[model samples]
Target: MTFNIAFSEVTVTIGNVSVDGYTEDIVVPITVSNPNESVGGFQFDVITMPTIINISDVSSVNENDFSADFNIFDDGTARVVFYSNTGEGIPAGSDEVVLNLHYNGMDVLSALVDLEGFNLTVSDADGDVIAGNIVDGSVTIGNVVFFSSDIPDTGDVLEQVSVDISIQNSGLVGGVQFDMYDTPNYLDVINLTTTTRTEGFQIDFNELDNGATRVLLYSPDNQNIASGSGPIANMEMVVHDNAYNSNVGVNFENITITDDIGGSYWVAGVDSGTVTVTPGYIEEPHNLQAQDGMDAQVLLSWDPPYGPIPSDFSEDFEEGVLPEDWITTTNSAQGWFITQDGSSAFWTVPSHTWYMCSNDDMADDDGSVDYLITPGLNVSGAQNITLNFASYYDGAYGQTAHVLVSTDGVNFTEVVTLEPSPEWVMETVDLSEFAGLPNLHVVFHSNDNGAWASGWAVDDVFITFAAREIDRLVHYELTELGQWALTAPKDEVMSRFGGGLPHNLKVDLSQPFLTENRPVELDAFKVYRSLNSSTGFQEIAEVGANTTSYLDEDVVNSTTYYYYVTAIYPDGSESGPTGTVSATPVEW
Candidate 1:
């Protein structure tokens, strides 16, 4: 279609920044360019915000919706210019859009109607300002780089010093190096064995002085992992994008020495005791072994791995006292159980097939499998879906639990959504639809988004067909549209949505089905004491959701009273039937 069109309008809008708040007046710029044919009047909407990098550019714009894709003309043209963000922070984020065809038709033209809201959140976490509670935001310090992850203290592998870091840049490079300082002094290897670790993880950080080195995994040998050794200990690297600042300064903490395993270590000069903190403990190499005796040729009784536990993480430990949470599954010399080696491991049998991916293999593919799972997961699930798998899902990278299920031993459909991570909540899906599934073979999977390098885990497959609420009926009638939403005084419904192991309840089977003694599984239960439904309630019982099933222990002899129940989910989430389980207690 040969035609011409142009856009001419100036308008931008931003909703009030409340939650977490925004501090910019990002605007959308409209430009109508008519080629091929002549068409007047520009009209369009700011449908969605694209990757925004500069907030200042947006703040000065006339349009409210900043980083978004907007087309001014219908007459298609191969040549076009548009605005986009690049570094640290810019256009925040939002599933919603902002700034519709707020411009007049005379200046802008658009076929796309209806726009949504836009949200933005950005900044540096370590610098002056840090981006926290990040959802979909990203850091884009273009052509600029700094130390990424902190330098790891090799503790006792006392060899060289350097850490790997995830760097983001487009610039001139400089020499990367390190140095030791103070009492816990170490040597700076002059002739370094600078080798890159994994495929994507190249931690050849050149240690210049004692300042921060652009390394991800730290080591004492002043080099990356050597050929075919265990996995390389690395971290994200901070590179100098510009020659002006090629050498970033390191600090005392950056002075790490790769300690040799089987040696004593010091913490704040205090004796950490004769502990062996090796990079790994593989089984194939008589010198290395996994905690669970995974690849061990001999029986290795499992012991408690130091540091971290669900309780230890969520506990109140005093000075000098250790926490009690790590549980041992097996103490026998014959049974399969994970052991507490230098690092966490996965293996039950002595199959001699146990290895963890190190910073190398753990990366995309450069095969250095010295990996480990810290406080590794151990949960259960059922069907085409997984139940409760534990994982520190890299919040930065959208990750899904990779799961494998098979009706027969040969075929497998990768289940995309595994159990939710780092939470006690349960995510359940129906597998009754599987061709042969809800049937036989099933295995949990973890889809590593390739960011954290930390693998996903599964402990158990709880194939316990969800014992649903017995005889519970969730009819459309039972499901209220906005029952949970704040409603008019009498608009709320009473539901058993929060049905849990209730400690107390009073079920008066007498005048059932009334305002009183209405055992609702919502906010609360309003129990009434009346001889009949004809009279109003006497507010005899006031039980909260925590009060699941109540016991009508106190009742007048030969008296008839009704009861109600209500439940409240922890989120102050309310549900109901308005007349949950109403019963009249008769001396039956």
Candidate 2:
């Protein structure tokens, strides 16, 4: 006997999914609805764009009711077959997922998942074809938000640094907002600005009471940013002076992006970065020792270490005229000239009272080009060459400035472009590429491109470099106790200490021995003392870098105190502590 059953039409659908471009092994489900009879078997081919995504596998959602198998083709097709092994059927239900299609993303794009490529078939328990409606779906790849810093590992304290917040493989975006957080003791946010990619957008930021900086960027005209990879905003910050020998992290939270029509975008992932603060290029004192003296005094001695040397070509523009050998070439009447006046209404004052000025506001013509050239420099044996200067520019009418270098003073190569700064700011340009050139010349060029713009002013120009060793040294005569210990005559030392009677303690000192001949200019020396050998050290006194010894009268008799010394650079960076030495003082 056979029982006849009436089966309603079934609707089959491929579910849509959104994932990140870096995602792998994504699962999309195929669902069934409005089926009156039990479903026995089904077969279909899932197809997609070959370059956007590829099918990996297909699995049955209801494993006990059905078994599934799939074959992936090279043309971005997956043939899926599902059937019941025990001759039983899956009881039809409302919106039931039968099979899942797994895929891997090949690129950042959108692709249609179509089911019309192959013959889609469905059968009932009586081996009869079931009429059904098939629906297609889609897959969308999303964007990745991350952070990057120019200072990858380490930066000096009080140095200005920048961190970039970027989006990768992005879609068309209309607006973005996020909150950034960092240790307040480590870094201080100065300002937020737009990059070249988002220069047309308006940007603003607010510092919350909870130490979070909230930033927002959007176009007033509802314009969208096309798909690309770049920094949307740049964060300018200054490292705190107390952040030395520490790692500081910058993080993002509550990130959101919107399309032109106010739809939310899917974010794939987010990443953060950190910077370490370190004492740069300074050396610590060496061979520190202490000895007991009569009348309960502790005598300390150490060798001073080297520090960063001063530049040879430093000009403050205080002579009221251009130095000899300096040249100026201009197409305008008002070219480069020295001035101490700051009464101009168009341009700001220079860093110092006297500075070089290229006044476009005082020019007669519309377009002006001016060049200030330096004298021939001899940097044949220098390393880490750099050019630093203080500048004030008013770019109200689109004036431009640049720093260039040349070997013949005729053919110049651009080293860096200067940005508009209404106030006085320091600019640094790396010149290591032209380090070995014997006759290198530097040029400061300014242009007002057919516009009545303000002017540019510069002061305190310096061209610094490092060499193998110091060429000259300043001699010190016997003045202080520290100098007398290192430079006193033999007879003078005997007259002070040779007698057996009670006398002041004498600590002999020597100059620092250099393993490698890299000589830096010294600033000062710091002395630290502790009761223990390894910890609890406090700064006792500071002396000149040339001074080699110190007399500590603030000590207890017959008590041992450990001491160490460190060198301080001109930039306020301190070296690591030297080896510890012990001393005991007593009354004779």
Of the candidates shown, which would achieve the greatest lDDT relative to the real structure? 2
> Which stretches in model 2 have alpha-carbon errors above 4 Å?
1-84, 87-98, 101-154, 280-588
1-588 per-residue lDDT for model 2 (tens digits): 643434468777888777765567777888877547677887887777434567777788778768899887777577888888767777767568888887876543333333333567777777777776678776665543333343344577788877787876456788888888874357778898887878789988898898888998999888777778777778888886545354678877887877666766655456775766666345675445454434677666554553343567878677889988888888887788887643243333322346798877567364356888899998899877878776765354457788988888788888887876434455677788888889999999877777665567877687888532322221112225533432344345446645322324221223322223324456678899899978899998988766766778898998888888887776677888876667777767
Per-model lDDT = 0.26, 0.67
Model 2, position 556, has a per-residue lDDT of 90
Error of 1 at 507 (Å): 40
RMSD of each: 31.9, 24.6
| Full-model lDDT, candidate 2 | 0.67
lDDT of model 2 at residue 501?
Answer: 20
